[model samples]
Target: MDKINALGALGALAQESRLDVFRLLVKAGDNGLPAGEIAAHLNVRQNTMSTHLGILTRAGLIRRRREGRVIRYAADFNGMRGLIGFLMRDCCGGVPEIVRPLAEDFSNA
Candidate 1:
């Protein structure tokens, strides 16, 4: 990803509510959750949840789709992968050991 896009994504996630919402969506997996369900799960008001979802979606960290009258949201896996790639693009600076733990984390996940 380009630096500008990466910075935007990072900035969006820098907020507590947005970060929590993204992590919750990621844990929810590809099936994701509806807006109401997400609000209930997070104990947030529907309007507040909407705001958080909007920020995440605008940052390209999440996606929203209409299912009947409800809006279901899911983490953008490609965006996540891009962010990870950007972070490790120049991993180790020639020393592989520096990134071993990160590789292990990915493997375990």
Candidate 2:
């Protein structure tokens, strides 16, 4: 992603509720979760959850799809990869050891 898009995604995840929501969605995997289910799991109101999901979707961190009357949200893995790539593009002065452990974990991600 471009700098502006990356910044937007980071900013969206910076909030507590948004971060929690995003992590939950990530754990949910590609199947995703409906807005109502997400709200119930997070103990948030429907409208509030909708707003958070909307922001993430706008930032390209999440994708929304309609299934009947339900709207499900899933993390955009490509966008997530782009964000990580942007953060590690320089690799801390070309020293892989600087983030080897983190990179190892991200490999499974």
Candidate 3:
């Protein structure tokens, strides 16, 4: 992602509810969760959750699709990859050892 897009994603995640929402959607994977389900899981009101979802969507951190009358949200994997790539671009000044732990963590995950 470019600097502006990265900043937008970071800013969207800076909020507690939004962060929780994003993490939950990420965990849900491609199948995602419906809007009401997300709000219920987070103990948030539907309107509030909708607002949060809008911010995430605009930030390119999540995507939404309609199924009947329901809207399902999922993490945008490409956007996530772009953000990670942007953050790790330097990679500890090209020292492989500095990023070994992170690589191991990803492998373990």
Candidate 1 lDDT tens digits, 1-109: 9898899899999988889899999999998999999999889999998998998898889999999998999999999989888888888794678788887999688
lDDT: which candidate is best?
Answer: 3
lDDT of 2 by residue, 25-104 (tens): 88999989999999999999999988999999998889989999989998888888889888888777868787787799
Clash pairs of candidate 3? none
**Backbone N/Cα/C clashes per model:** 0, 0, 0
Question: Each candidate's lDDT (Cα)?
Answer: 0.90, 0.90, 0.94
Please provide TM-scores, in order, for all candidate models, with all chains considered together: 0.90, 0.90, 0.92
Alpha-carbon lDDT of model 2: 0.90
Off by more than 4 A, model 2: 97-99, 107-109
Q: Which whole-number lDDT from 0 to 100 does residue 22 have in model 2? A: 91
Candidate 2 global TM-score:
0.90
